[model samples]
Target: MSHSMRPLLPNSPNPPRIETSSSSSSSSQHRTKRVATPAACEACRRRKSKCSAERPRCSVCVERQTPCEYTTLPTETHLRAQRRKLSNLEIRCQAYEDLFGILRSRSEEEIAQILQRLRTGEDAQTIVKTVQDGDLLLQLSLKPEFRFRYIFPYSGEMPRHLKDAQNPYIRSLLYEKTVTHLVQPPMYIETLKEISDESQKMYIAPYHTVELDDPRISSMIVSNWTTVSSDNPMLRMLLQIYFVFEFPFHPCFHKDFFLEDMFIGITRFCSPLLVNAVLATAWHGYTRMKNRAEYWQPHNLGYRFLAEALRLFELEQETPTITTVQAAAIINLVYNLNGIDELGWVYTHKSFGMAQKISLFTPNPEESTEWQMVAGVTAWCLFNWQALITFHTFQPPVINDPPSRPLPDVDEEPAYYGEILVKYPFGKEPVRIYNGSVFKAISQFRVILNDITKSFFNPSRTYSPISFEAAIEFRSKLRIWYEDLPQPLQARHIVLPCHLKIHIHYHIVLISLFEPHLHTDNAYNGVNPDMIVSQSRICFETLMRIYYLRHGFECLDTTLVQFLHLLGFSTLDEISVTENGSAANEAIRSTLMLCAKGLWEQGQNYYLSEAVFRMLRQSMSVEDVTILGDIVEVEDGDGPLNLMAQELRSRWPIGAFSKADDSKDRTLEHFIHWWQQYSEEKAQDISAMEQDGPVVPPRYPQRYGT
Candidate 1:
């Protein structure tokens, strides 16, 4: 037969083929037989016949009506693939087991409680504590994949500004050294037990008092009391303003109780010092609101009331109570309002001392009285005030350190003074009452402020440059604290005084964080010039915002003055680097001038403001003279111009003039003469420039440029 016509079959000594008897039977009976190898099938192997290795059943086994099975081991490649699949399954099983273990350890009740609190907007720290106590958090933390899942899940998407490593403030906070130092276990007061006795006595010393023998002082106090008791129109208005404006920012007393007491003729029961302090604070706020310059004089109504309050406080024979501490804090605030920072610091110190004496810092847990809550809030206020003073004056805080006692939880209490309706972007609604949460947040920020002061601004500490990492960590914490604030406290556009103050303080901390870089040419080594300029602009913008909000009224306090001083120095530095008459340079100059003019107007008792104003004026005069091409020579300080330059150089080391170019320096006297002669000419140019645009840079000779 031909190869094409032959039936296919396995090779064998004798191939079997069926013969057809009939056409139909032939088609069915004629079949091809397949061969099997030795390894193909058990049936074929046992029968000693060749079989095809097909799946399910080999051809030889099928034709014989027997089952087929392979008994060979798998190849190494196949085994490896199977082992990989099994390993993946084992890993998934282990993960599930870990999750189940965590769930098993946490009771349903505990998890339910945590979920309920989270739904109700409980503080993040409280919720974290709940989970941590249940040990579920611990398990999650132990695993690398789940470490940040619960605690800091949002860390992956931080704000762009925060993530920028080139940003000086952020850079400082990100420094590894800073993070390590900040996160270390706090150093406890090891000598607490040893010094407990002495500390108690020392704290109480501020409250020890002799009975008042001065009849005049007592009569003045009595008169002030009569005025408050009678509710004269002016006094009533002041009190209302205090409640509406000042009290929210500095809540020393419960508003409802104070108002109720006043209405019920309970003024007699209240301490005279406390009453006088309130009157003084109210009057101070009123005068500032009214922009009454005369009322800020030494013997004005505010000062008289403040003096009487101090006199009564000094004469009290009893131990200082919550009211007494409140009185001291109010009086301290009054001092700050009058731009007497030294006195403000003194009074704040006394208030903190009295607060410590009464154990306000370490309150009795058994007591849940309103007074206890007020005392706790007062302690935190004192801490905030102390931090501000420390930052501004570069002084160490007299309050020792942050208290270990937790802040009072008073959110459940009724809102003080009912709901204060405030007009906001979301329409008029009751402003959120400042409660324990606000107090606690501010207290926490104060602790950070204290650290910053010690690390960067403390005059007593040995000079230590703040690492970029430390600054960034602090800044990060501040930002997180702000971001995590309750909706009510996070209003930026509402213009609530208390809320504004919080915002201002936050920016103040930011300014302080960048202030070190401002003096990069002097102390801060290797800091970028761009960073200094940017930070200075931030400070100016923040100050300008405050100025616009208050419109220069009631904003001349120590903190404000210090802010302006820093702004002045920073502006001068900015001007020194930027080209004169350029838009950037002029904008900085305008801000400096505006700040100087404002400070000069309100800077009667404020020495710091006066100094800042003078510096700004000097800087402006130097810029003007330089623009007019009046270069002065200082060779051995022979001429009046040379003397003037030397004096200017001494006063302002970071002045507009380049130190390398000794001929650029000009003395105050020489500057004054030049200003007098150039005033009219400059006015016309400035006016024209204001109407048109920035003045063109004037061409100068090579010697003059030098």
Candidate 2:
């Protein structure tokens, strides 16, 4: 094309020349001479931009012409072949060295040498050609049954590519025994039996590996759907879960692991069926109720999976849907975001990451998938809101500076506390924070519940006052029963400890605050004893109902007696209050005595008898005292009461305040009446005192009462 643009070959053996002439006779002579050259005009050397030697048209034709016809040089196939052969030779040599290095690294002898050294009962040797076969052969060789020896012990050589065997007899062993053991997952069921029957952690699934995070496992799951059994719902669930929660790790490896080129390799490898199966499994898990406990329970694999599933569903919602079931399914799946507010679940760390990822693909609100994802995320957000609302009820407002002594008029709206439901004291911030969190969580639950139900044309059901009251009592009694239990047994009996406790607390605070509204018998216009008692009953019933509904028989019959007694009802199946009180008092006394003994051992001066006396007096009712029988005599006399009286008498001095028998007799009557009143009043006080027992430190030894 141009003189300077002529093709130059670095390996060329020779260069060509070109000539041009003005005269026809000179051109004729030049043409005759130049016709013998093999190379084309494009490959010819030229002086500046012009040709020198004359040809058929000469220099005048070349200068005047706008175009020059030139034949380009062809590549030398022989030279190319020679270069290719050199490259192939280099590659072959490198491969041979790599193979040798691999074999040395693995401490393996040449196949021929291994075969020559083979003894009786040696493991089988495999010779493979392909890389896959080499890998398999290597795996077989590493088995425990294979007794491979290194040529150089100190060199620490390892096996190379046995399949491309320079030597062909490297023995590979099938570790039948080891493989069998591996195949047989250990029976943790037996070890579980050794523990007391009261353990709950036993119910938690065993964690062999967090497979959802494993790239290889994830890829295999996504790419090999045909081989995956339908019965392995867990696997499918897990894959979907991972896809949603852990979007980065797809098929199993990170999408970025393909060097930001996307998981082209893995995606290419995954058949369409595998992708469908994974998605189907996820959708299935979301629609079914089987995963609720597994999904929502804090820190479980199900939770991780559910989170991932939500993400995947959010991503998938952009496409067309066949039915409302799919819509409802996706909505319900996102509804689980509400469950993320549970203890030990930090949404900021886990769920927020998913949100950010979602934001990347979803920016427009009008898009259907965006809306679906938004609805799901909003449902999650609402759950937090519900938690926040629940938190405010129990949380006392903490007023700072000019204290929030009086609430503002309903008409005077503030940004935060303007809403009647949110109007709480700023002083009780701690409790408010706790209640707020619960309110937020519950609100999210309600929101998602409403949203999904509405989508499916099923309106959400609000709890009626009666239902709400039932819920309160049910949960409160459940709490009391749970708290009354021996500590170890409590956790086992309770399904969700935080939820149970929160429910009780929330109801208690609500009833206390809204007694005027919550009371059953509106007889006492506002905040009266009837109101208090009715509100209390409402709380108690609600708590109990919720507890029973949430956790079944393990908590059944638990607070039946205390609950009936609180409600002023009697039941034949109930334990007598007197019996319970007596037992409680005895336990309290025994505990106090043990504490007193410890104080005594520590060289404390006061008698443990005094502490024991205080504990009994504080914990025992007249009924308890009566049941104690002869133990109620004075210290100077035979009974506990007499003993106490003797001590009082000694302190007061019986003779100092009395005149003759007339004054003494009147005083005696007054004293007896006063004593009865005091005993009656002190009974409840004592019971309360025992209930306020301390947690004994482990290092302290138990002591019997004084």
Candidate 3:
């Protein structure tokens, strides 16, 4: 306590007294006192000014009207007094020095902050450390803002623009740090506490790291890339596109936080390879870029971006990161979309291999960081993606075990962030509802689908006994899943393309499951031909709505094409058995026409669709096939999609369809000629059947495991 604040005793000869109080001490002549304090500012003494003293003045000192103090050292709490006075003097000295600095006015905010700290009684050393560690003050110290870009490790595939940088940042970049793959997942704060507290086992490790510090790569990257991000303009634009269009279905990474991390340069979730891979996949969404048609071309901007990611993948393969797996998976998606199945499968193996090496399949939620839980959620997504593709393409999945991780808490950001905005896709007023409701729903549904894949489908067809009861069991689970879906995601309520896609996918999977059992089962008469026809009609109508609404853009997707052609194959089978004008026949015809039109529409976006459409036509009579092609286009309709299709199809790779003599001719006439030739050949086979006692058609491997 200061002398003025100390209690006064009436008996004391020199009792401390307030000047305002009526007392004998006040009437006495105001006596001067001499005092000294430890660590008083020498600078202030030299200047002959009052310095570093903020304590209240005594009554005698106030009555004497002194401007400064001359006192003996503080007698009480002497040690504490010395430290406090010393810290105060040091802080004041810093303030004085900053006041005359050449950049004094520029650091007004920083200096004011320091003064505020002093007033708040913070220790001097802490304030100094804070200022030293922070960049804001250092930045203000420069005339122009200092450029403090970080050099990220580059692969041989570092974009050609930024090699051989001579800056200090590259010196650190040249040090190849052997890092583990601990890719963070999309996490919400609410679900974090539910995560397991178990420590991760370090037994399984994806090892190997090399110094990727090629001076050439540094030059190529120049100053374009940062520790967590690249300066690519396309990275930002395509990322938004991927989230808006693709993320709703997959929900692979947490969209909002992932974007925030990219902007603020957080390294855990976002990486250079992942960014480029995302860009490559999102390239399909770049429908109207300067009137160019580079959908599947090797030399487009997105492909070049993939080329960079490819090199990075090789460079980072030995020491795989969570983002490396993500990048590889996305690259697989792009390649598969373009019908590069071998490369797509190759990358799938690569991605799945990395996932295995990192023990991503092993659930270790104990003592979990939010990122680990996120990785768990993301693991589910990647496993589903890998499983679905593998099952569809006749390859068994390598990632067999499902991860047991905490579910994303849906109510966390329930109101904001993920509101779905459906526009022209709907005829009524658009609905805007929270999108996160479906994420958990999709994850749960994929779990069942993964089970179905392991049970029935494989390259060897090991589970051969096509049990009608088992199919019914699987179908029951599907119904239960649909019934349990959130209200907005249900039929008549779904508005977004992402929601509609799940519905269509459900019915398509049902069709594939039931189609093979129809011919050989008397015990399973529950699945009649009419039932199959109804499902086909549902898929056709739902699919056409998606295409015509300008909402769905899976036109670049070959898997959707596979589904479309599967419906066509069923429609053809129906045509052989049903008479014209019958309900089944009429259903078959509508399904066939819509399927053909869908192929034609999808072909406008990708050349492969046109060839696939005509190939289906060769199975029907010329008169019937021509009728399928005579349908009118949707009115005032698909304006955006039509433009995208036109632009995308404007240029094609030289050998897009096939390198036949007439390959260059993509005109309708050339296709018709080809279809007619195939039809005539089929007719010749029919003629040979009369003599050869029913010639069998060319064999196709069993489409369904049955």
Q: What is the C-alpha RMSD of each candidate to the true structure, in Å?
A: 32.8, 28.8, 21.8
For the record, the alpha-carbon RMSD of candidate 2 to the native fold, in angstroms, is 28.8
Per-residue CA lDDT of model 1 for 137-229, tens digit only, reads 221112222210111111212223233444333222112222222221222122222333331211111100101122222112122353323
Per-model tally of clashing residue pairs: 15, 104, 30
Provide the clash count, candidate 3. Answer: 30
Please say which candidate is ahead in lDDT: 1 or 3. Answer: 3
Pick by TM-score: 1 or 2, better one: 1
What's the CA RMSD of model 1 in angstroms? 32.8
Greater-lDDT candidate between 2 and 3: 3
Residue runs of model 3 more than 4 Å from their true location after superposition: 1-235, 289-298, 366-369, 412-434, 457-465, 524-559, 575-590, 604-611, 617-621, 624-706
How would the candidate models be sorted by lDDT, starting from the highest?
A: 3, 1, 2
In lDDT terms, how accurate is model 2?
0.29
Alpha-carbon TM-score of each model against the true structure:
0.50, 0.22, 0.54
- Which has the higher TM-score value, candidate number 1 or candidate number 3? 3
Best by lDDT: 3
lDDT of 3 by residue, 339-382 (tens): 34455667878887888888776766463565665576567768
Q: Where does model 2 exceed 4 Å of error?
A: 1-346, 349-365, 373-509, 512-706
lDDT of 2 by residue, 141-238 (tens): 22211121111111112212212222111211111111221221243333333434322221221111012223343223222333222222234344
